[model samples]
Target: MADIAQEAGFRKNQKLKDALLQHKALSRQGFSERLFGLLFSGLVYPQIWEDPEVDMIAMELSDQHSIVTIGSGGCNMLAYLSRSPKKIDVVDLNPHHVALNRLKLAAFRHLPGHGDVVRHFGMDGIRTNSKSYDAFIAPNLDAATRAYWDKRSIAGRRRIEVFDRNIYKTGLLGRFIGAGHLIARLHGIDLTQMAEAKSLREQRQFFDARIAPLFDRPLIRWITSRKSSLFGLGIPPQQYDELASLASDGSIAPVLRQRLEKLACHFPLRDNYFAWQAFARRYPKPEEGTLPTYLKAENYRAIRDNAERVTVHHASFTELLAQKAAGSVDRYVLLDAQDWMNDEQLNDVWSEITRTAAPGARVIFRTAAEKSVLDGRLSPALLDQWSYLEERSSELNLEDRSAIYGGFHIYVKKA
Candidate 1:
């Protein structure tokens, strides 16, 4: 059996070593936690849940900024590249994510133009994707990344074949979204209808009539009640508990219902690729104007030109920050990784963050719960060094098209 560190990508960080080991041990105490851990170790998220549009606004990223971020799906990393940051150092515990990030970077660098890259990633059933990979992307990939995609699956097809097939349906989140469609089908509800909604009223009516009813289906209730079942949504046991705690009846379904409603009704389908993926299981049509910020036709040149600025690593955020000189990094995007940590782990990461953050540096993150965990968790002195942009965070969270997270946070280093 693989050790927790090996599977989870723990290394050389004194602060995270024992803490992660203990967390792993606790995860092993229950079957659900262990199963979710395994799922997490694999490809969990095909795309990030946080909204990069809100992130961009909150960070005010520019050519002068250097960013350090957790690379989940590498979507936001590419999104940040559009601003032409000095550099983006991406770290993730999953080796699979590291490879995916590397592959995306290579594609951006070597693909002939914007349309090729968009069709390769944004659409399914493109026969030329594999050919494009062989001709352009494969040669540029690192040894490990190349080997990962080269390995064949049980279907006797290389995993890289997913690009030609449907890359969105290939990861844990993709599979989870696919499962939701299957469940909806069993109940005689076609979620794809939600995508056809012309207005917010129509979206809500569709949800109330079709998608919303599925939540009450006995099968859905049973599956959702089991903590193991949500791994595909990238909700670890800890986050599941946080979400459940927020529900009055201690059921996650209600919280999820509200979020799904926001996803379907709060934004137009033409501009929300997240909804396109959830309901239609693919990004919006290229002409639909709803692609991710990085995938936009106008921004493609900037993204391709700035591809070399990113560096991917399979390491902990704290470990990478410790290696950097003090006051070097200008932006930090932690996603929801901090919710998986205890207070000690939180303090340790914040210590490195404070140490490495340049003057006027900004940090952004999201939480599974409505409030920031750092409020009562970190020491007064450490917390005092930064100012929490509560009003701004709330405002931006409203604009976050992803609509999945409970809160979005922004903290700026004090002058």
Candidate 2:
């Protein structure tokens, strides 16, 4: 049976709305924000965009660390589990994300093995996943999380049925990628061809011949101009502004093209699962390519064993940190979420982070632009307590396989 109180609390999306609604209700920006909140209230990222491998290096994760992070898709949390962290408190404003994290945790704890785990998360269109959920995963889930999956979506199927098809192909990000594929198909270009490239040169040749031309089309530029156009990429109105500013001519097309170039040509397709997701829309077979840290076969047992150390909270990071003891957290992972925050919100989060950070704590985050969002935004008093790793951040930003973010940043608490 569902815990009525827990279910009710999780169902309310007002906290998400409050965080996103920054302008007057009648304003265009306000409408866009609210619309994003609506779409985002459901699933957003099927997989988190930030590179956890880079994160592990930046934070220097060890068995001694206790991490508190914004749980976008729960991939990072589970990936961190492979490090055997002492504890990880995963907080998110979206109830659906909270449910998803809990579901993954339950899967790790109760599923038969790595193969079953992959069947549930890695591959797509496996109808038996619902059965697996019923027999193993569901029984282990909390009342609220169990009720969430059992509930029917608008499609008149249980939310758990997402695994029955392609779980990775169902979220807002998934639908956005699907739309991109549709748009490309209409242009006579199969974006998936990038996945077939045998080498970097081949990848660049395909991008130049097929992909680069589309960005220059009048229709493409026109569509990318609208703020609403990027809602699918999970770029809120504010972050859209930050991203648009990166283009010299104030067109997002060039910026997007540059990012896509990195995804297509910067790394070998066989090793970059992020590239697989962007071009192939699915992870490659085990023999064909790599996977996220948490999904890899070698890390499965460690993740499953450490699964009990994570606690998922459906609340803002700041709110969760407020309830924790001062100096309790050793690491923080904020994944481009600060790009959506106003100055006050930034300061509020930083205040909590500074107050709760343990000695020698490290924080890693990404941004839509090429500099720390904290500069000229967060209070100097709060910001001064941390030393920004500008050089290391620049190197890691280039190394991040996701290729979407403009910058990856790390800040260490002053000893």
TM-score of each: 0.93, 0.96
- Candidate 2: lDDT of 323? 98
Kindly list the per-residue Cα lDDT of model 1 for residues 1-415, writing each as its tens digit. Answer: 3345334543433333443343444444355555566566667777887889899999998999999999999999999988999999999878778899999999999989888888888888998898999999999898899999998865688878888888888778998999889988888888888777877788888988888877777788778877777878888777888888887765578888889988988888787888988998888775664788878887888889999999998789988998999999999999998877878889999999999989999999999889998989998989999999999999999888999999999999999
Task: Give the candidate number with the greatest lDDT.
Answer: 2
Write model 2 residue lDDT over 1-415, tens digit each, in one string.
2234333443476788768889986898888887777667667888988889999999999999999999988998999999999999999888778999999999999999999999988888788999999999887888999998999755589989989988778777999999999999999999988878888999999999999999998888988988878888889989999988988776799999999999888989988988898899889887778878899999999999999999999889889999989999999998888998999999999999999999999999999888889999999899999999999999988899999999999999998
Global local distance difference test of model 1: 0.85
Stretches of model 2 off by over 4 angstroms after superposition: 1-12
Error of 1 at 16 (Å): 10
The deviation in Å at residue 294 for candidate 1 is 1.2
Please provide the root mean square deviation of candidate 1 (C-alpha atoms, Å).
2.9
Which 10 consecutive residues of model 2 have the lowest summed lDDT?
Answer: 1-10
